[model samples]
Target: MPSDARSTDGSDPLDLSGGERFGVWRAARARRRREREEVRRFTAVSRRRRITWIASVGGVLTLAVACIAAAYTPVMAVREIHVEGARLVSSDLIVRDLDGELGTPLPLVDRSAIKAALVKYPLIQSYSVESRPPSTLVVRIVERRPVGVITDGDAFDLVDVAGVVLTSSPRRPDGYPLITFEGGSGSSGFAAAAAVVRSLPTEVLATVDEVTASTVDDVTLTLADSGAVVAWGSSEDSAAKAVALQTLMAAYPPDAVARYDVSSPESVVVDPR
Candidate 1:
């Protein structure tokens, strides 16, 4: 019988022989094995990538933690404090006040504490604090300058331009003129007097012994040794009045003049003895 002939029992006409069927089965099995091997390779590659990513993330987190820890340690602690822009107030006093912040970590230093410590000093008008990395803290201060002295009962109170009492003593300090106002430092008269005193030239200021103001418009200054009185009208045209007074004083010597009226400034009058 032909090898390709149909069976008489109605079996499949093209049915494979045993060897051919075995070969087909082997081919399918090989294909399935190859597919399984490819799946395993892909899974292994994916797992390796995941492990590397996790390791990289863990390394970064560990490095960040170490850096933060170092910042809070003695390695970044404040070792020195520097003070600047202090004139009347001693730098040593400011440094002593900041001693509490010493040895604290640079990143952990409390700025509010520093400010609180500094506020106790009335001389410090304004201040700034700077943190220099790894070891140093810097403090810069602006001090209030005393412009005049006020007589408080028997004691003399040194005051700044804003009328803040800087210091008080039983005896009056030299170089600062005595200032008196009708309503005290908070009055408009004192405000006007303070402004006039601040505007005077150094030469004129040196000769002033006392300043008095009853109202904002009526301000007067008395010369130190000469006792010459200056009638300065209001705070207006103060600079011009200062110049006029200087010229008038130069023209008529201090001993020769009793009074100077520079209220108008443009037209100055001098009363001579």
Candidate 2:
């Protein structure tokens, strides 16, 4: 051993040789390289996160601008109007009534205003509105059905089951019976008469000439050719009463029986004149 490498206390001491110095230098260099690699990884992750956030923000802004442009532009405005399911009311009238909604945007049409205009026609029972994109608006309506005719001096007023007068004509229309109520069409008596008339079978309905009701429970019907009368007490058990009347007519024939009382359908009464 060289004098310069001697132990201070004659014990085995650390030797600062050239080989040991090289090993220390290698350990320090490895530590610095690992720290640099960690920093590079962190920087890469942070840069990727910033890029993702920017892309998400840009996409949201583009969608918002496109929607605003579509809503305010005239490309989506109503240019045509179509009316459907209107029978008694003319399609021309519905289109004319909706004229104010023509230039408005399809998404901004006022449904309440459309309903207000249609309410002026008493025949429209129900209605719906639909928008056809790019330029069209469609309105569908269900009209009231007339069941009977009421005598109105010089003309006859056609009425539905709810007693709404649809139209008046100079003479009676075919397939409808004359309805006479002690009170006017608005009375409960007329409602009962309407129910009885509406419940009659097609064969029996065609045979009815006149219907009269003083009260809701005193409805009566007169046959056309045979002139046989039917006493329908009330609107209750109407289906049963119709069946019983049909059976009685079939068994006795219209000429043999003067009247049928099916008000209490369980105990039907027949009067032969």
Candidate 3:
């Protein structure tokens, strides 16, 4: 209104005198807003990290529970039992004995029960059990082989090299040599005879008629076809003895020799009938 006089309309006289002060206030407010925005971003990032960690832990727990539950459910139960490598032993009997495992979970199959049931069969020397997931159990058996037979009055006891009685028959079974030794099954004589029998080749063993031993070093045999006697010294050097006997038998047929002395296989002594 008048020269050098302030207006009454609350204007700053259109002047730049307070511009620097207002600029300071505006910069401070902008800085405060920027700090608040940074804090909010940091909080959001931490929250997302916590949510991710919780989700990962929950997933692991859920998977572990699912696996454990599946192990005990019918999905993992045994539905079939199979027997393999059973020759002298009955496969059906072994399968029947292991029937208790059926319907049981594979992971929970009673191994003690299987062992107890398998021990009933003496012919089974060793066995292994395997599980096929989602339903099958396999049992493999190894049976003892009889090397000779012993006379037990009216019955004949088939025995293996270890002197274990495999079975008994009312009548004399063919194809096995008759064993006779003084000291019941534990004598050195029996051991020597059993070793000699075990060392015999498949072809040579088939022709053995009888085995007799009163002492360890006097194990002897008689041929079935020719009735020729074989003087086997002991279990020592049995492989050589077998080879010598087989060679001598080939050179001089059993029909032509009355006795074959393989006690010293290096120099065989053949006596003519």
Candidate 4:
């Protein structure tokens, strides 16, 4: 009989002995390992690219924030301060108080602080402040106007309609009427006196010299030239009082009319000259 081994032919899956098959398997395994190593290298390169991208974006954001912060920091002098509707107050004084922020960040100006400082000035009635982006500060003010004169000892103080004292003059004012009160204390009587003046006719008010109020019910008016006294008595029926005075004066010219009493809105009494 022939040898039991079969003849190796080209038709066989592989023309190799057992040792050759083992060698081929080892070679295939090595190739697969090399390919896996190449894939791992590609993955590592991709992860490195992603990290670099994130770092670059973070760096840009930080730089932007730093630039913005630096820009807002006060590095320049105050360029402009616009003041509007100012009459009684001096713009220089208001600017002086704001000088505290000369080197401070304008974008970060404290609104409350500025307002508190400005309101301290007695002349300023109401004020508003604003900032121009990156540089300027604007202050707007409404000042008190002198409405009447307040009597204090030998001196007289100019006051606003709100009874706030503004300025004092050595003598009585030429335009406004002098206001007097009882107990020699004339501070609180300013508002009441002003109310009486405002309620009177414009023509009558123009000729007023002094306004005396001893009590709530007694309000006396002294004329400018003749020094005539008109008993006004309280602030009620002011329009009617003005009309009665006009009618009385029409009937009897003011040259001879000494005292005109209009305390009662319905009646008019003309005292003998």
What RMSD value applies to candidate 3?
Answer: 9.4
Clashing pairs in 2: 217-233
How does residue 190 of candidate 2 score in lDDT?
87
Give candidate 2 regions above 4 Å deviation: 1-61, 71-74, 152-155, 250-256
Candidate 3 lDDT (Cα, whole model)? 0.91
TM value for model 2: 0.71
For residue 1, model 1's alpha carbon misses the true position, in angstroms, by 53
By lDDT: ranked, best first = 1, 3, 2, 4
Q: TM-score for every candidate vs. truth?
A: 0.74, 0.71, 0.77, 0.60
Instruction: For model 3, name the residue pairs that clash.
Output: none
TM-score of 3: 0.77
What is residue 211's positional error in candidate 2, in angstroms? 1.7
lDDT of 3 by residue, 112-182 (tens): 99999988887888889998887899888888888999988899998998898888899878889999998
lDDT by residue for model 1 (1-273), tens: 557455778778568899999999999999999999999999999999999999999999999999899889998999999999988888998899889988999888999999998998888899998888878999999999888999999999999999998888999999999999988788898899999999899999999999999888999999999899999989999999999999999899888999999999988899998
Winning model by TM-score: 3
Using lDDT as the measure, which candidate wins? 1
In the range 200-259, model 4's lDDT, one tens digit per residue, is 666777888898887767888888887778888877777787788767767876667788
Clashing pairs in 1: none
TM-score of 1: 0.74
